[model samples]
Target: MPTHTPPHTPTHTRPRTPPDAPPDAPPSAPTQAPWQAHAQPDHREFDATLDVPYRASPGARRTISIYLSYPDQGRRHRASWQLELRTRKGAVLRRWHGAVTLGARPFTLQRDWDGRAAGAAPLTASGTYRLRLQARTGNTVITQEWPIALGIPPRLAMPAFRPLATGATHHVATMTPIPTGTILPSYTVYYGNLHSQTNHSDGGGDLAHCTGAQDPQSAALGPPDAYAYAQAHGLDFLMTSEHNHMYDGSDGTNPNADPRQATALYRQGLQDAIDYNAAHAGFLAIYGQEWGVIANGGHLNVFNSPELLGWERNASGQLLADTETPRSDYASLYSLMRARGWLGQFNHPAPDQFKVGATPLAYTADGDEVMVLCEVMNSSAFSHSADESESHRSNYEAVCDQLLEAGYHLAFSSDQDNHCANWGASYSNRSAVLVPGDAPLDNTSLLAALRARRVFATMDKQAQILLTANGHLMGERFANCGPLALSVRYAGAPGRTAADLTIIEGVPGRNGAVSELAHTADITFTPAPGEHFYYARLTQDDGKLLWTAPVWISQQSPSLLCAATN
Candidate 1:
């Protein structure tokens, strides 16, 4: 069947947020306040859980444990704790208020119930529930909450598709199997702000929030259709970074003035994703929001814990976990997310999208951070020329290059930023994560790999861009550079049955400047000393060319003499 690209920008407009709902919601649990006193910097821990096989016949006690971790010290914080359980439909299921020992500082906290609700009331039907934790020390709240999932029975519920949080990263797809005894690597992509018909400034989608909730057309193409499309097109995962009307006030900076309808729609979209995931297993969707900051270039996406960040905004109209600080910008958010062990990345920063500057990498202080990634491909900018698209891709590549040059760690990815399915026709099956086709496509495993700096990107076609150093498949690097030995492959039936490979290189540091390196049937690029970076493009005999992100190179030579001179 012939496919058409979804519209790059939605035509229908949505209404601005109403004057009621609180603009800034509280920051979710996992995204804790940066100032929560890490007195024992080693005492901090991140906990998560999963209960996928929740249905176990009748009278069976289904249970899952809260996975714990202390990235610092190897101490266990196992002690008495309290548990909170909520239903999939957003209702309090039961609150187990008691002292339960955790035993291990970084261990799973498991709880089993006899399929009962409150007061020993039997849970009439089998389903799913959300579990959260409150760790305390001498009546003091040590941790706000540790979110986890529960498996009740009959598999009636599934988790929601969350959007990437501020400075977060993401991905989707399958890959070839690696030889035995050798470990294969995976990649992640992150994106958001897919407004189908909602008010460009406010209005959250009305129906599942996949599109504009206010627009009937968008409402019709809700979560189910998105899920079906992903599964049919071989996509591994999809995420929605819907704008929070509550966070973006009517005036653009009022956190306490979001309309009720927008808030309701955001709430509904998250629920829809959770409900859809329950039925479709491998094809996953995540729930997240654009935290809708009103600043010139301040738009941060938040995911995972929705309830905690309910109405957490400040006078300046920016998201305030507790109080505002110097690092309130994108880089600061990245730093905070990395410190807390969450994946974050900088979105597009061009004049049309973010209007911040030519590049957003300068915002990151010290230029040295851990577990961070950047957006190389944004869905909104796909239709632009190859040179235009490469600018953003180069921005991310430059960051990756700086990190590699300085010995710090960073990664790369691409995102649809699909507000609706408007751009799907051309970009159909375009965005994806390169994970081992055999690995469990579950949230825990995929998310862990994503945070570990493993990912790649395809701008608008299936162009193969491989990053290897010294013949070793280590983690990815940002920009295309010399001695990097980058290989790009493109294979698609654009118009003709056969395809041709071409190398596209940008003008050194100027992303917009471009030149053709070579046009050949050969698929590999052996970089020369002056070649900064190179990407492969495939064209059909009919003349349709597909572009891929560049494999960055270093200007310095390998020998000590050349390296010392530069």
Candidate 2:
């Protein structure tokens, strides 16, 4: 084991202000900000150390950093290195390749391995493994191997039923009796980013080849690193929904040389998520998969599943069979998901020719019961349009509204659909769940809140909705008469105020147009009959927007009936 000296703590140097400056003058900027540095390593002594533990946990990362002395003090050394994980039998499990160059002074090279073979290979079995580091310089080679072990720990189980604390009052006046299984109403909103990726899929970063660069061509953050990043950014929950088939070796290149390797990689990634959630208490990590079909079917992200379910396509790009179903049966897939108590959501639903062609409801006679939500707002630049055009921006809203009209009853959610490792930093979208303020911030509670439809999707991090219909919060279903009273209250991020608020209401196939409601933060309204679904849209002075989950109102208590059936 090499002795380790922690990375230097950055020192902030404030600029000096002029003596004649006024008291109210703005403060000077810091002289040396951390992000301002170039890609070159710091000027320090040569050091090599592993940041990982001796007994590595499965799905966790083992990081190694190398600081090399200035290239012979004069002659430059265009050096490179390779890091490999080998089994006790001397067979290579995974390998990472990278370039290393020394500056005028000592500089560092760092990379991480997530304990799996490259390009979606299965996680290595628990046993003794050797991490081999090879440094090459003009025919002179230096090699070092360190023995380590890997194992999986017991997972932390969630409580079956944790009752909501008493003494909380409901804002909505229930026309019917509250159901026995309904989650309590004392809920507070928690923010999270539901869509993201690690190196397990097509996204970049995390590999030795990409690390240490100012901007790597690929994603550098692994699952554990991504989780920490999200927590540091103030997110309550983070779900990295990697593409299910992205590692399936279907492209014919067969990077792993084995078809099963892809599935193994996907499973390892999910396992990593579980370990992270168990290790972190306050911050919740949810496991999910983004099922994509570039040829036609579009994309769907299924969450909270005990195992993985993926679609299989033929060589011609046509659907063949899924993990379980014999044929390309959407209903069968939904059945399995429902059986497992899983939740499926439409990922960046297309508006034009790229449309999924089949809405989530189209898969089953009871899609509303299975497909819990749809992405009304996705922040991916590739999937989302900057201009709020009908073809691009309005298409998502239109599709969601159309589904609601058709009786799909799907809640609206916003996600970054982030391929880059940006995670919660993408302030354009988030999934906000209304959980009991005192409820345990665990997977069970969070999923329960989502299943209850106590959620709102927002584009701005600071935006919030205190919406109620005859006292029921957004996403709640209620039985009301011809005229229903609706209340909407908006809160904007600091330095920003609500500019306009609009209410949209309609039944499926009817004229669903938007009407200006109010410019203030709060407003009340009475809607006419036949308006079965209603939702509010708020625009901020800064041009950021937010859309709340729809509130379904019916003359009959269909919501209660729907809940009963589910």
Candidate 3:
């Protein structure tokens, strides 16, 4: 993704203060100093704060809270200030001019702003806008700026649902049938980008309004724009997991004093996603949020929930209560998500600057089973180099190994984790869902497939993998009786060939060991005893990678190691 810098040329100005006006306070000095001298005062400084709503519906009255504060020097001084609201392209949208007098006491002023131009033109397009404030006294001028996003929620007409194609020609021998009683019996692969962001949260880019030219400050696309981008770029599904707290304005200071207003803005984001999903057909849009706290637990992506769960904090930065779960306990968070039938996945579990906590490796079976998936590949910028040294383990892969070692049946997924506007086509990390050919491409089928763990993740957009053990699919569990037959099949991306394919066998309480599986497009194997789970990892000539979900092997009588279908 390229970075853009917004142009900062002021196109509108207003002189709110008269030059001859006396200071607001009585002068303590016998004579007035030159405006230049007043401006040059080392102690004379001001700060401006803008409180803009995270989002707004079209034609709604959006109020911006502006706060300006300056230190008191026991002397009265006169100054003029101007505020300008401009589009991302530097087009002036609104301007306000005013004058103020500094008294012996520190001066603090709060003002409400309605997004409108001088001619009553409403700034309604969805995109980023610049809010600039300038304060001048005695010829010296200082300015500060903030970014504001405005747009109407997306509400497109719904398209009719189309059933998946079904025919003998559409069937792939390697593809397994959906578990009995599932939505569809036969399945095909569907690809999508699962994680990304927009202006609704901390992500940059315009959602409702696009200036065509990318503004450096707001270059990321919003939910609706991102969905459109994904569909246009050949993706079958899209999910935006913006930071959960960004919409609530919970900064430990009750900054957004009106919680109702903050909640409204939060719901607006959900509504926009629902609207986009409703308007499109054959393309699925999943609504989710990245639940996180930098100091406590790392980030977790929650999908398919009916309501937005918020963690409210008090002044001391302690959790007060979550929107869904009244208690502030960490474990209860997962409990609440499960109670709402949401699927949670650990996102980017590496120890990065933004994430600090015990790795997913520390998760125990007590109640952590709700977290079913791990993000093995995140963002396009991740390093693709492989390390043969056992001690040099990557955080993501290490966590996946630990989960299997701990006896947790987890699935694998890869996402763009995109903050920019690229959406589905950024860097190629994607989740491929195996849905029945006649299954409806909607949220129910998608979520059901995910819950069933019928999926694979790939770093190459065009890569696909199919695995079956004794007629059971990836994410299924069966007993390892006699010889456990496993089949692996793969398809490479354009201009790329599979360089290596390895089968990894994992036993409870032991590290997973990789076996020298065949490098060909298809292979079969009968694992030795004590192998409780199996998965495959394929590396392409182009350095891309694909990982299938592990199939758990148990000693239960229902398990059967049948002959290979081929």
Candidate 4:
């Protein structure tokens, strides 16, 4: 990590924007007129969410809430959805269904669950129960799942969080070491997938029939197999993130499973990845774990971890994972991640998930340091698109907007959560990682690029996008109270041209919406007296989209500014 000097801000009078404007040049007005929004997203998206306790006793009362937000008329889901409590055997124990309250502001649908089967029948099990919530939109299914502990002893209690938006100043001290060396340097864009699964746990099958979650460990392919597949498909690198719990041999349903076997399998996965990377000169094969579940919790891809993280144990109470970040305890996980210099991605997120401190998408200084990318889009999980024609995809850019606005810095990544072992082939989308020149196109540099947030999510593998502010590259944060200039650089394969491009600005910590500041590729504007972040977005004529990580800058009040000088 390296330190940087803050540029001087001329305060006598706000310097005119476009400082480079020729003295004899015509006057410059605001470009396309930047607009204002309070808490909406930079892109148009709709989302539905369900929140409930991660664990509840068999008969204890529990509360559940369903929320619908960000209305889009054209791609609207039926207001109606269903909620069901089911057994590991897939038998429904209890069920509920209804329409979400329709309004501009996101609203919640809540009810009490008494931990019993429908009609008061006693649920006679003390194991994990799956709570499934589902909704139908035009051609998509919006669903979420939460693992409810019926009788198991509590490990990570329902998380208690703090609102990160208001506590922005507390994290000011942690926003340093933006980049290790020169802020801007010659670089090359390397594209790859930071997520996907293999046979180590519920993935890895031939592309012909790898259409969905295969039985964990049932495939002839594993991490090395996936790496070979991705390399053949022209991916720069591929990480096979196995589900941690699946190491127990029961997809997280067998608590008494052997802890020794779980550790052995996890360690072996890491070794296999290391071996593959060593043998392959140009392609990187990474191994990590997809930690956590859906519903009350969200999945995070943990890379560079020494061992698998888990909460389950054998009947003898021995831990399964040698190194454990308590399951569902995201705060603890972030702290540990920072301590270990481990980087991760917020995988397939929704606004209502990943509630850190204040609310979902809220900030945590540790979270700010640990999470590098947020998956903005994911190709269809079970699609057998051996080619790049997979049109079914889910958009999570709104989640990215919410996280950035809430003060956690992250780059955008488009992933293919390959449950069917079809690595890099389900979609054309790729996470374009920008590595500083002179750095090797290996695991280390690729991970470094992610840590620096010098990355973008693109639906076109060959497209390139980067954002810079004040001559600083994307994923940069600094203190400024002067003319803030922004620029977008993009290129596409031989036949493609950018159809639309825009600069989007948002008030970090505003917990509000972002605005399209301009359509120009370059613009200079005076920033207001607060924290702000800006990003670049462009679309191709075919509707393929790409996004860059944002540049963040904060303005200090006079009192704080003077104290610093003294």
> Which pairs of residues have clashing backbones in candidate 2?
172-471, 204-218, 204-219, 205-218, 205-219, 205-220, 206-220, 405-508
lDDT per residue as tens, model 3, 58-87: 554555444333444555567677878886
* CA lDDT, candidate 2, residue 412: 77
Error of 3 at 109 (Å): 49
What TM-score fits each model?
0.46, 0.57, 0.58, 0.68
List the candidate numbers ranked by lDDT, top first: 4, 3, 2, 1
What is the C-alpha lDDT profile of model 1 across 224-304, one tens digit per residue? 565555455545566555544333323222434334444555566668777877887755676555543322343444444
lDDT of 2 by residue, 29-145 (tens): 456332221112111222222222345444656655443333232434555667787864458878876655533444455555566676777674654455666656444333444
Off by over 4 Å in 2: 1-184, 206-220, 249-260, 313-322, 325-329, 352-363, 381-395, 508-531, 556-566
Q: Higher lDDT: candidate 1 or 2?
A: 2
By TM-score, the candidates rank as 4, 3, 2, 1
Which one wins by TM-score: 2 or 4? 4
RMSD of every candidate to native, in Å, equals 25.4, 23.3, 20.7, 23.2
Q: Write the per-residue lDDT of candidate 4 for residues 10-112, one digit (tens) a residue.
A: 1122111222221233245334311111111111234555556645534577777665543332332335579999874558988987653332333456677
| Shift of residue 500 alpha carbon in model 1, Å | 5.6
Query: Best TM-score goes to which candidate?
Result: 4
Please list the residue runs of candidate 4 whose C-alpha ends up more than 4 Å from where it truly belongs after superposition: 1-184, 556-566
TM-score of candidate 3 on Cα atoms, chains taken together: 0.58
